[model samples]
Target: MFSSKSERLFTGMIAAALAVSAVTPVVSVEAKQSEKVTYQAKKQETIEILAPTSPLVFKQGEKLKGKDRILNVKIDGKVKKQPVRWSNLTTSTIGEFTATATYSHKGQTVTLDVPYTVEGYELAIMHTNDTHASLDNAPKRATAVNQLREENANRLLIDAGDVFSGSLYFNKFKGQADLTLMNYMQYDLMVPGNHEFDLGTEAGHPEFAEFIQNAEFPFVSSNVDYSGDQYLNALYSEDLTHKPVDGKLYEGVIKTIDGKKVGFFGLTTEDTANIASPGPIQFQHYIDEAEKAVKSFKQRGVDQIVAVSHLGFDDNPAVDNDLELAKRVEGIDVIIGGHSHSRLNEPVVVADGAEPTVIVQAYQYGDFLGTLDVVFDQNGKIVSHQGKLIDVKTYAADPTAVSLLAPFAQEIESIRNAEIGAEATAAFDNPRDAGDVTKPSVRKNETALGNLITDGMLDRAKQMDGEVVAAIQNAGGIRAPINAGPITTGEVLTTLPFGNTLAVMTLDGSELLSALERSVSVYPIESGGFLHMSGMKVEFDSSKPANSRIVKAQVLKDGQYVDVVPTETYKIATNYFAAKGGDNYLEFKKAYEEGRVNDLGIIDWEIMRDYLVKLQTVTPSVEGRILDVK
Candidate 1:
């Protein structure tokens, strides 16, 4: 009976102490950029801080007594100011005390009670990048996204950009259908990926704006300037919110759940400037924009920051990849990344200040959804993180989303099921097979389809500019080759799924030399230094140093060897993907940015299709165009 009475008294004291602490006055906070205050408590308790909301915590059975001394302020983890008010806190039960904050201004005070438990709030991030309009339910990815939403109602669905452009579905539906699908999936937000601007016509923007206005969630971006771009301006105007960090306007967003604040900013790779037709709009530096947005969010009392970036995961820190971004930017909590279409079987944790930021991505074609579950403490620090690539194949499709896509699926089925091409043998098998080009009929090093693509680009470039010299085709881009028989429109679409236009760039001999060097550097590395050429003979020694392995690179002009010098410039023909260096060719990106000019009127696939039908036969054979040997 005595022990029970003692327990009751102890519990009552704790309750009284907490009530008093909740009613205490909020400190007048004047925060600067990169600076944070510490409210040290005499006890230990877990608390959470959410966005657009204020919360508080305090030591149990303790009261503010005696004079208060200002504690120190931390800036970038170092002591900056030494003047935070400290009160003497004590617990009658002899346990450590915890502290929280209250917000009070002009005598209008509100109290927030902290959750005094060990577990923090779980933030589930469902991210997709480079969807490229793979919206059909039968294909797999569309079904996977919907399943995740049903399985995890608390899920935050985000797209890392490039949601449109690529598949025949985009061209047939003009993105309206894709937007509807994303709406059904209930995407929390999406950033502008490079390919979203596939159509060179400006009229597409206004329609896009209308789509956003009706979207279930917002589209977030920090660096893309839509001020003068009337089409983009119309679409994202209302959703635009300026942050406090910099006076610059941003298309980023902040969302809250359970008293916890989370901020999301979007960034598309600057390389988009050269690849896609951004017209008059300018893309800001990725690092600069990210830094400003993070600072602005922190100023708004939002410490959990994520960047839905379209930048690919680069192994090198110098290039634009998610891994490089994590290392370069310190405060980003997580990066839902895309554009490289990397299948990161696992997530990579990058250290950000006192915590680690998670970087993740799902491979393209709706095969997977990247999930990052993060838990944060009261002080806005991440306590624990769990991430994985959830394969879409494992989940049962939601009947609702499937029903929503029924009409679109029917339309696609009419085309896919209609036989366009017949193959003598399976033309292409996936990468899992040995010695297989992407298609079964074509070998990797050389293929009829690859030759046909290179020839088509060269044929079109000659008509556009008399100076056209050489063309190159990436092995990965050619999805499949003809099986020596009848061909149909559907077969062609499957082979060249993306609506990539022809782009001709003038490259100086020096730049072309560097490109050739890169093409041959890792010759022995599978899928490394292979090239399909139309106007050049490239020979390399595999045993040579990586950076200087190109033994010989010569361009033919008028059926004779041209006296090419490093200073001389020549016109080159290729698709936009290579110009932007989609496959880790930084030199190509650099060339497109500084030297290549876009002639948007040209279309490569159309030309290739026309050329193939005219020839009535395509027997591609490697004719020592690119020779590499140890």
Candidate 2:
């Protein structure tokens, strides 16, 4: 709530106490993150809450562990064998519980709050988000999940969506095989992401509704309302007594977790309209729908609430991220979110005191599994929350997941002409200029993958009907590194997972220059709009003022590099997202609106794959196409 500069600096200190990085973590189960509790009182002993970083899952019909390790008490900078006294232990029901650790020294007593979740049903709530069908990690993820399930008697698995598009797996099976594997994992509930509808309106592709109907788990969406398709209407559920605020579609549902009614609702971002073709499916406001669901849960006397959300956690407040949702509405206890590809090492608490919400998300590609252990007070309000991000690759992949995925792998191998499944001849590296992995080159200046992508687009555009001279791809579109060694279809998809179709747009030299200027406006901060180009050489100073950063620009014309002519028209190739004003490429959007941009309707992956096949062996090097003369 800081307005002035001085106030902002003061409030910044307050934020550190709540959401500080892993070191010297200071938070209690009872008090929310916003409240500043005094710990400087004289004559007090501090106790270290030493609990294991692993998730503490309790399953139904499973024996509870004896003598759980709560915490070690310390008095006046000395470690004691045990805490003076332990309080708050009840085993009658399954719910999140907390205990108090007490120690006495120098006529003063200090108390520490220790929390644990008790259960009569399941031990772990395992979830993954934004996997993007990178099935190569499927075996590794399954390995981690299976080991966790073995130790915990009861387990609940869920997904936060975007299990569509990416690798050859989705390209060949179209989400059917992804669902088959998810079914094998026994996911309890799943929500649809914007990418789930990437093929919804297209012909000859499996629609999202079809995936929903075939899915073993329930697809929940508190804000999405659609009933044109009979199959969708029959399967969709609005079972919660209270409807979402102004929602004409399905709300949330009450699922039995830990032998208790835990109200679980789903919310996808409203931006689905522009991102994907969600035919007949309309979205309701995110915060309003969440508030409505919370009200309904409270009315039904449900204490624990979990929202499986795809509403991303972005810096833009206008986008309605998970943190903003928690702040805007009260009553939600935990929010498992997706769509931003954010990997939160620890769960974040937005405890501005109105029913504090704990938010957690795993990084994309099934590389990590998110685990959040929440303890609810007697009144059902969350008292304590602990979060952990498990590295799936740390353990051996389970054989079951590998077996289940084998058939699809075989199918993809055949369709790839045995090339996509096989390894590539050379390696493509994307590292920082300082020879470090800290900051990737793609987001800042330019990398080999960015060059390769734009080069493919330019090559493909030249093959098509037009005088296409250049290609540009926003940095954000490149998802991951190609790494080294043999490149499989999986690796290629991992690098370009978005499945953005290529568009060859007509842009005059002036507009092109404007586009390049906008691309580097927020230079060092890492913007997705930063353009990677082929057939053009751009030399710019990032320190220069925005919209005027370009020191020089050139395009290949008639087999030679020449200065760009402002009035000269050229057909430039770029992705659909950039062409439609995504990442704030307004010039491209304007061109599309003016009918100057023609969407070639060519898929981007094909261009890259075809380029790779033709080359057979590639040794791409950065030769100053995008120079940062800082």
Candidate 3:
């Protein structure tokens, strides 16, 4: 240094320089630490926890683990999946619960109070089939529905069709009376049965159209083509819709229940074209339409499918049926069926495939309400199910339904109580061989009621076409019985409620013989085609084969039983239903098509009522009209 002070100053300056260099290094280190801390805080703010698309719903008694409980973490606008650590999740109870889900990502942990549900996911379906306008017990049915709905919020009330005919309610009101209560009970969906088309030919289904238009719920019909019918086509939607409007008709519908999509389609028997007056309405092949419906539902991401089928349970192997549908279709989960009027006390499960299809049907009348509770797994597959028929009569009448039904019941009461000026000598029992197969039944054997009905039909047909020789009545056409008292107009209406007109057909003796063979084809099994004779008698051997069962055939010629000449042409009378191939009367259908048949345009119940008035004191008995020998 230059001097002692200067040297000290230079030394101090050098010391200060050294101090500044060391301090500068320390400040640079602290600034970098602050920046690192700020970056860590910003990164922690960008890391957000996102819940799953589907709600975290766990089954009862299921432990929360695996990928199902994983949470998605969003980091810097990118999603990152991470397993969530859930706080003490109690799934033993079935209800809503809140729990904390801890998600950790990139050394940052997030604890969220996520809401979840632990439930059995039991779907309750309340169904009915073939109620057939039996509204006498509708109030009780409403009560049953209300009680069941109260028990479970997840429930659907559906009808499998045939709510159009069979009782005084349909006779007078043309389904309006039933509709009032059905609306009150809130039916979710309904399918049209064959009988729904009964009035199609008369007025192009004016009453049916009105019934459907005024309905509170929608209709699903996949196989029936309403496009041909002017009245129905307007309301018909060929496209499957997720949100279907009430009172409209659809090929299929997607119903969202409990955050899950359930698909529904409907099918009526193709035999409806022959059995009922569908008029311009066309019926497609059921299997084909059902396949299309399932495909459509699946394309829309619906897994659970329900078919409301009017096909019989195990009716005709030649025709379509629910059993065949269940076996053939792959994705259908449940079938609520009608037409055969099967009383499924428990659900029938078809488990031949990977998944099972459950089938249930209530009996003919509003006698029972079918209930099915299906438990679905997390994958939307049916894990377990329980189904049963609840007797409508078991429940107390609902006050609201009773109030709704009062006016209808009052009007029906007046018509039902009016006497027809005829007294029955005995109770004309319309027996069925349901419990005891060996006993005589109206469907399998000639009963007094069948004889009376056929006699009335013959007498009425002779008035229209005097040449009409014999009258044949399908036993299935006879619905109810005439009590052993003063017969009322309601009794006759209930007995022959289908509103079938008289038809006279000209058939060769050979064709008549073929008809007789067809009638007795299913003889010990109680076929609906069983012929009840008024002017003919047939003896058949039950031990013989089906088509060759007839042993002898006779026709009443000039009030005498004579042998049927195969070469001779004869005139026969039957209901329009049978004349037009109903109950598989092919010969009658042939005659109808060949212009050899004449429809009298008279209602069958009116014909029976007039015949009863003519007979004054009605005492009819079975006179060995149909003989079956071993």
Maximum-TM-score candidate: 3
lDDT of 3 at 480: 96
Writing each residue's lDDT as its tens digit, candidate 2 over 350-455 gives 8986678888899777889988777664455665667789988787877888898999988887765444533344567654434443465677778877888899
Judging by TM-score, tell me the better candidate of 1 and 2: 1
Per-residue lDDT for 1-630 in model 3, tens only? 245564321111111111112241111111122312233212123455675577777777676568766777766668778777888567876678887777665545556667788876566799987776778799999999998889887799999998886667888999999999999999999999887888897336777889999999999999987766778889989878888998899998898877678899999988777656888888999999999999999999888889999987765545688888999988888998987667789999988777888899997678899999887654556778999999889788999899999998899899888998999998999999885769878888989999998898899788766788899999889999999989999899889877676777889999999999999897788888998989999999989998999999998889899988899999999987798678988988787655576555456887888889999898758788899878
List candidate 1 segments past 4 Å from native: 1-117, 137-151, 200-204, 238-250, 315-321, 352-355, 413-441, 444-448, 457-469, 474-487, 496-531, 538-553, 557-559, 562-630
Model 3 segments more than 4 A misplaced:
1-121, 419-450, 456-487, 491-630
Candidate 3 Cα RMSD after full superposition onto the native fold (Å):
13.5
Deviation of model 3 at 480, angstroms: 10
Q: Report every candidate's CA lDDT.
A: 0.63, 0.71, 0.82
Error of 2 at 597 (Å): 21
State which candidate, 1 or 3, has the greater lDDT: 3
C-alpha displacement of 253 in model 3, angstroms? 0.9
lDDT of 1 by residue, 1-630 (tens): 335554321111111112224452333333222223333322222121221122223332334443222222322234332322222333333223444434332333323333332245567888887776677532355566656668877888888887666555665676677777777676777877777665645434554555556666667777777766666664543232533122122467777754577888888777766567667567888888888888888888888788888877652234356776787787888889887666787787888455677888887757677888887665556667888887777767667767777787678767654534333233433232354333332223555456667877787778766788988867666675555456665667767766566667678888887877776565444463345678877777767887787767788898875645789987887766677676777767777555364533334555666666666655545476767655
Backbone clashes counted, model 3: 0
